[model samples]
Target: MTDMNNPDNGGHGEWPQQQRPQYPRQPQYPQQPQAPQGYPQHAQYPPRQPGQQQPPYGYPVDDAAATTVLPPVPAFDDADATTLLPPVPPLGDAETTALLPPVVPGAVPGAPPAAPRHRQPVQPPFQQPAQQPVQPVGHPQGYPQAPLPEGQPEGRPRARARHAAPAPQPAEVFDPPTMTLKRPPAPGPAGPVGAPPVPPFAAVPAQPAPPAPPAAPRGRTGSPIIEPGLQPALITAGAAALLAGGAALGQVALALVVALLQLLTAAGWFRLNGMWPARQGILLAALAGFTADAAVLLADSDGGVAAVVGTLGGFFLLVLVLQTFRPSDPKERFYALTVLGSATVVTALCTTLLVADWVPAGVGAVALATVLAAAPLPGPKQLGPVLGLVAAVALGLLVGAPVALGALAGLGALVGRRVAAYDWPSRFVHMTAGVALPLAVAAPLIWMATDLLA
Candidate 1:
C-alpha cells in the first residue's frame, strides 16, 4: 500500500472542482403589434393662459357659471400686498392687555369687537365686632368687693369669681351647775335617805345557754386518692383484656379486635388533642394502623416485627406528604403533624400484641392492675399503684408469665390511668382511650419481655 499518511502521495493531492451544470434559457415569444392608427382618439384639453381662469376638466358647465361674470385678478404689486392682511394692534400694558378681549383672526372687517372684560373690585376681609362686658346684676349696697386681678380691666369682671370671705363673729362662754353628794347610814334592809324601802333579794331564774353554733360542715381535705371515671376505665380495660385474650381463638378474630382498638385510639387521640372534626387525620391514622396490622398478619412469623416497622415508616412518610397538601396555616400544619404522628405511632403499637405470643398474660396483668387501682381501698393515693403492681405480679405468677412482664404491664396500666385522669378526662375518654391505651402501651413491653425471656 502506498504511504497513506504521506502528503506527496497521489491520494493526498487536491481533487479537481466539479463545475455546476447549466440548462438552456427559456425560448422567447414574439410581441403582439400595436392597434391601427385609424381608431378614434380621446378629445384633448386646451392649455391654461396667464391671468386667465378655467373650469377643471370633467366639471359641468352650469348656466350660472356661464352667465355670471367674475372680477379680473389684480396685478401683483408691493402696495397691494401690504393691504392684503389686516393691521395688527400695538401691544399695551399688561393690565390693559389682560382687560381687552382677544382679537379673533378671520372676523368680519366691520363687526363690533367683543365687550372688554372689567376687573371686579375686591372687598375687605370681615372683622368681628368687639364683645361688650356683662354687668353684675345682684350686688348688695356697701358690700366690700374683691380686688380685681392684675391685667383685668376696670369695668370687666374676671371670667371666674374669687369671692371675699365673710367677717368673723364673737364667741359666747358656757357655765355648768354644781352638784352635792349626801351621805347615807350603814347598810340596813332599807332604802337610802328620802327613798322607799327595798324588798329582800329574790333568787334569779336560771336561763339555758345558747345552743352551740351548728358545727361547721366539714369539706374534703384533699383530692380523692382514686381519680374519677375509674369505674368506666376499669370496664374499658376489662373489655380490652377480653379482646386481647381472643387471640387463642384465631388470628383474624384477634386482628379484628385490634383494628377496633386502633380505630378508637385514633378517634380518642384527636379528641384528646382538641382536634375533633379532623376526619381526614383520624381516617389516615386509622388506615395506618390497619395497614400495620395487615402487614404483621401477612408477614412470616419471624418477619412480623419487621413488617410492622416497615409499615410504620411508610405511613410516617405518607403522613408527611399528606400534611403538605393540607390547606392550613403553618402553625396548624405543624400541630397537625405532631398530633398525627403521635396518633399513628400509638395506633401502630397495637400491632405488637398481634406479633407477641404472650398477649393474654400482658393484657391480664394490665386489667388486674386497673381493677385494683380503681378499688376504693382505705389508704394513701400511692397505695393504689402499689397494690396494683402486687396484684399484677401475683396474677402473672399464676399465669406463668415473667414477673418483670407483669410489673411492666401493671406500670403501663397505672400510667394509662393517670393519662385518663389528666386534664379532667370525660367519661367518654375513659371508656374508649382509657380502656384500650393500657393494653396498647404495654404491648411493646410484653413483646420485648417475651423475646428476652425466650
Candidate 2:
C-alpha cells in the first residue's frame, strides 16, 4: 500500500492521486440562478429578505420567482442608448430561476431595428397557493360600527341611513283623476229621452250592391302606362287618312303624311315620356325634314310641309341642350332627351300642318283637320260636342268646304266628342275617332273636287 520510493506513487512531497470526496447526499437546497452575462449585476434582482421561507425543492420561490416572472427588459429606446436585459433572478438557487438564454444584442445606434428574439416560455413553478385568511371588508382594522339607537341590540346590521316614515306616494297625497260625473238631478228626471216611447225600427231595404266595373277590353289587358291619349290609334288614323287623302286627291301630297307621322311619333310617345335622347333625335330629324321640305317645295314636288320645321327644331335643340347640361340621373338622360325631342318635333309638325295644303285654300283643309285631331274636347257634359260642332261648321264654311262637307264635319266632330266623353271603348277609340272622323267627312269632298277637276 505504501510504495514510498516510487516517483508515481503517493508519498511524502508527492501528493497522491486523490479520489473525489464522496459524502452522503445532504439536503440539496435549490441553487439560485446567476445574473445572465452582459447584464449589469444591479439590474438583475434585489437581495432576498431575511426570514423569507424558501419553498421545497422543485417548488416555486414564491415571491422571488414571481418578481422575476415578467422580465423588465429596458425599453427599446434610442434616447437612453442602453442595452435591455430580461430581469435575471438574484444569483441563488438555480431552481428558483432556470438558466435563461443569453441577452439578445439590441440594435446599435443608427442601425435598422433588430429582429426580436424569440424567447422560450418560462414555465413558472405553478402551484395552488396556500389558503390565506379572509380579509375584512373595508379597512383591516375594521370599520367603526355606527352607534346603536335606543332599544336596538348590539351587532344588529346597521341600516344605511336612520329609518323614518316613508314619504307619501303621489296617489296617497293627491286624489287620482276620475271621469267627470254627469249626475242627474236626484231621482227627479224620468224625462225626454225616456219620455219618447221607443218607435219600432223601420225596416231598412238592403241597398243593391254597386255594379262591378266592366272588364278591360280583350287584346289589351296589360297596363297602359304612358301612351298617347289614344296616341297609337290617333297616329294610325291620321297617317292612314293623310296617305289616303294625299293619294286620292293628288293635290294634297305626301308632306302632310310625313308631318302627321312625325307629329304622332314625337308628340305621342317620346316627348310625353320624358325621353331626352328621343327628343334630341326628333329635333335633328325635324331639322333634316325641314331642309328637305324647303328643298322640295322650292322644286315644286313636296309643297305640303312648310319651313316651320326649322324653327321648331331649333327650339327643341335648345331645350335638349339645356336638359343635357342639367343635373339628373344618368339613366334617365336618354328617355328625357327622347321625350323632349319628340315633343319639339310634334310642335314643329303642327306648324308644318298649318302651312301645308290639302285642297289649296290658304288655310289648308289638312292643317285644319290636323288642328282638330291634335286638340282635346274634355268639357264636362255635352259642352265639348256643342262647341266642337259649331266650330266645325264655322271653320268648314270659312275654308270654302262644300255645305255637305261642313255638315259631315259637324256630325263627325259631334260623334267624336261623344265617343271621347264615354270612356268605355278604350281611350284610343275616341282619339282615333277624333282624328279619323274629319278625314272620313273630307273623303266625299275630295271625290267632289276630283270630279270637278277631271
Candidate 3:
C-alpha cells in the first residue's frame, strides 16, 4: 500500500520488474465449485459450508456492496493523491523591528531607505544542542562563538568590507574615538614647497649702540658739597686791576697770555683749577691786552677806527668760541661772555680817546657810561631789572652812535642768560655767526661812510 501511494512508483499497480517477488497463485477453491453454468458466478458468491468460512484475505462481498452504494471517487487521478498545505503567515511587529534599520532621531520618515551597506553578511543563528552552548572552532574551550539571536533567518551572507580603514583626520583635531585609517604620506620629500626660505641669521644687521648721557652739571653736588668762591672773587679783582692800571704794554702782554689760556681751556686739553676765576680772569686780561695793542697801533694816527673795529672783531671771535664750547652751567657761561663783550666796548671807547686823540674828557665819560650800561645780567631773580637795562640801552643807542656801540656791546650780555639755557654750542654758533657775518659786511661800509677826509 505504501509503495502504491508514492509518486516515484509505477502508476499501473505493477511493482518494478527487478524488485517484484515471483509467487505462485493458489486457487481458493477447486474452481470455486464450478459456477452454475452460464449463470455468471461473478454475480453471486457460493454458499459457505458449516464449520468452514471464507478466506482470511480476499475481496469480500460486503466491500463490493459498500463500493456500489457509495458516491464515485473523483476520477481517482494523480491530483486526488496530493495533500493541500496551509500558507505561511506574514511577519509580526517584533520580527519586522529586528529586520528594519534603526531610525536616526531627527531624520525624516518615509524617506527611501539608505543604500544597502556593502559589508560581509552577518552569520545566521545556529542549531545548538539543547543543553550545551556552542563553542567556536579552533577557539579556547570556554570561549564560545557569539551566536545570532533567535528569530533570525539563515543563509545571510556576511556584510561587505565595512571594516576597511576610514579617512585620516587632521592632527589638530580632537578625536574622542580615534580614527584607525593610515593615510598615505603627503606627495613627496616633505620639504616645504613654495615657502619663503628661512632667512640667514647672518644677513640680519646688528643694532647700533645707544648714545651716552650728557655730562653732569658743573659745580653742582647733590649733597651740598662745598666749593671755593675765591676764584670768582680773584677773577673780579684781576679784571678791575687791568682796567685800573691802564698801562698799554702790560695790558697787551696780559691779554695775549689770557687769550692763549682761554683757547687751551676751551679745547678741554687743560684744566685750570681756578674754577670760574680762570675764565673771568682770562676775559679781563684779553680785554686789557686787546686795548693796549690797539692803543699802540692806533696812536697819533687815523687808524683808531680800525683798531676799535678790529678789537671788537677779536672780542666777537672769543665770544663765538665760548658759545661753541658750552659750559655745564649756562648762567655762568653767559655771564663770562657778557664781561668779555663789555670790555670790548670799553676798549673801543678808550681807543677813540687815547689813540685817535679824541678829547679825553668826552671819550672818558663815554667809556665810563658804556661800561655802566653793558654788564652781565645778575641772576634769574634779576631778569626784570636786566630787561629794563636792555630797553634803556636800546632806546639810547637809537638816538646816537655812541649809544649804538654800547648797545651792541651790552646786547650779548643781556640776552645771553635766556639763550644760555639752550644747547650752548649751537646757540652760540647761530648768534655769533649771525652777528659777525652782518657786521663783517657792514664794517667796510661804515668805514667808507665815515672817511670823508680820504
Candidates in descending lDDT order: 1, 2, 3
For model 2, the stretches where C-alpha displacement exceeds 4 angstroms are: 1-293, 301-334, 337-341, 344-380, 390-454
> How many clashes (backbone N, Cα, C below 3 Å) per candidate?
0, 26, 9
- For model 2, give the 10-residue run with minimal summed lDDT: 167-176
- List lDDT for all candidates, in order: 0.69, 0.43, 0.37
Task: Flag the better candidate by lDDT, 2 or 3.
Answer: 2
Superposed on all Cα atoms, the candidates' RMSDs to the truth, in angstroms, are 38.4, 26.7, 34.7
TM-score, one value per model: 0.50, 0.27, 0.23
Tens digits of lDDT, candidate 2, 1-454: 4354554332233333474333355697786677799975544455645443334345556676567746677666543442353322222222222333222222223458646545544443333343342322322232234455898765333232433222211111211233221222221123342143222346567899999999988774544432224353345344545564564554236556545544444423332233334544565545544444454455443443324544655666776787788687876766666656644544344334323333333123333433444456565534544554556556657866665444443554334333333423444433443343334334334434323332
Report the lDDT tens digits of candidate 3 across residue range 129-216: 3323222223334333334347654333222233321222212222223322222222222234333333222454667989989988
Better candidate number, 1 or 2, judged by lDDT: 1
Full-model lDDT, candidate 1: 0.69
Please state the error at residue 131 of candidate 2 in Å. 37
lDDT at 58 for candidate 2?
Answer: 56
Candidate 3 deviation (Cα RMSD) = 34.7
Off by over 4 Å in 1: 1-228
Q: Residue 2 of model 2: what lDDT?
A: 39
Candidate 3, pairs of clashing residues: 118-160, 119-159, 119-160, 120-158, 120-159, 120-160, 121-157, 121-158, 121-159
